[model samples]
Target: MSIAAVRIIGIDPGSRHTGYGVIESERGRARMIAAGRISTASGTVPQRLLQIQRELAALLHEFTPAEAAIEEVFVNRNVQTALVLGQARGVALCALAQSGLDVAEYAPTQVKLALTGSGRAEKLQVQHMVKVLLNLQGAMAVDASDALAIALTHAQVRGMKARTDALAGGKRWGRA
Candidate 1:
């Protein structure tokens, strides 16, 4: 028997801590591959940026995801916080581009709505839902589960669209 191979990586970018999860999509099934965080504590600004870049590059190399999805930067009341997040996001994008992985992004509201069916859902609810969907063995931290939820959202939506198209007898991309 032959195997189908497809992989996706999802990232939640932050200056102090970036969260990521890897999932493989094969024969229309999405499976969790790995997850981790990249963080910098008490360092010079440039040094921290360099560290983030290095960590992201390492993650890309290891996962070798065919596609990458990142949570878009949101506007914060604190300008400095927003800038820091944007900086991290920039590095994440650069890493994916350098790795030649296709990148897509979803806003915070979009991710929340997609995962929990409501933008105002509590963090715990999203985390709990993600745990159930992936059949994770143990409870996951908020940031990590959030990253996984984002990936699961993409998988769920993509699968739904594919099924809908099939029922409607329309062709979609990626079908051989």
Candidate 2:
């Protein structure tokens, strides 16, 4: 059976810079569509949140992705910094929901593991894997590469689930 391509957008939310990447995935292959960061460096907390929302909304409209994925906010040493990051993540979630797309969240370790063999992979290792998996060249921002890694994680996960379901004779297995 031929598997249809799925367009997915992945987001790595931050207070000052929110990274986003779009990709088209079919079977085990994935192709990059677009990737960039939304900067909100010169604004207050609320203003930065609003900027993230508006820019994310525009990107959603432009990409028209079938699904979305976001990296979960990791615990930070500074509570205040974690709170701000959470706010940015909330804005990103709202934008994805408003676009009427199913949003999936993956932990940072999970994303790294999906891209690299080890969950403890370094940032540079993950970035290198992202470029290798997508056959991409040229300079890419670290944030942008991280976003693409998140997208690729979703693609890999969904593809595995599909195959598992197929093997199970189209029956729902494990957790609902």
Choose the strongest candidate by TM-score: 2
Candidate 1 Cα RMSD (Å): 3.4
Q: Give the TM-score of candidate 1.
A: 0.86
Model 1 lowest lDDT segment of ten: 1-10
Model 2: residues >4 Å from true position, as ranges?
none
Cα misplacement distance, residue 14 of candidate 1 (Å): 0.5
- Per residue, candidate 2 scores C-alpha lDDT tens digits across 12-106 of 99999899999999989999999999999897899989999999999999999999999999997999999999999999999999989999999
Task: Give, for candidate 2, the lowest lDDT window spanning 10 residues.
Answer: 167-176
Candidate 1 lDDT over 1-176, as tens digits, reads 22345677888888777888888765555678987778787698677888888988988887788878889988979999899889988988998899997788888788779878899888888888777766777866676777877777666666676676676667675564
Q: How much is 155 displaced in model 1, in angstroms?
A: 1.6
For candidate 1, the lDDT comes to 0.79
- The C-alpha stretches of model 1 lying farther than 4 A from their native spots are 1-5, 26-29, 164-176
Instruction: In model 2, state the lDDT of residue 70.
Output: 98
Residue 136: error of model 1 in Å? 1.1
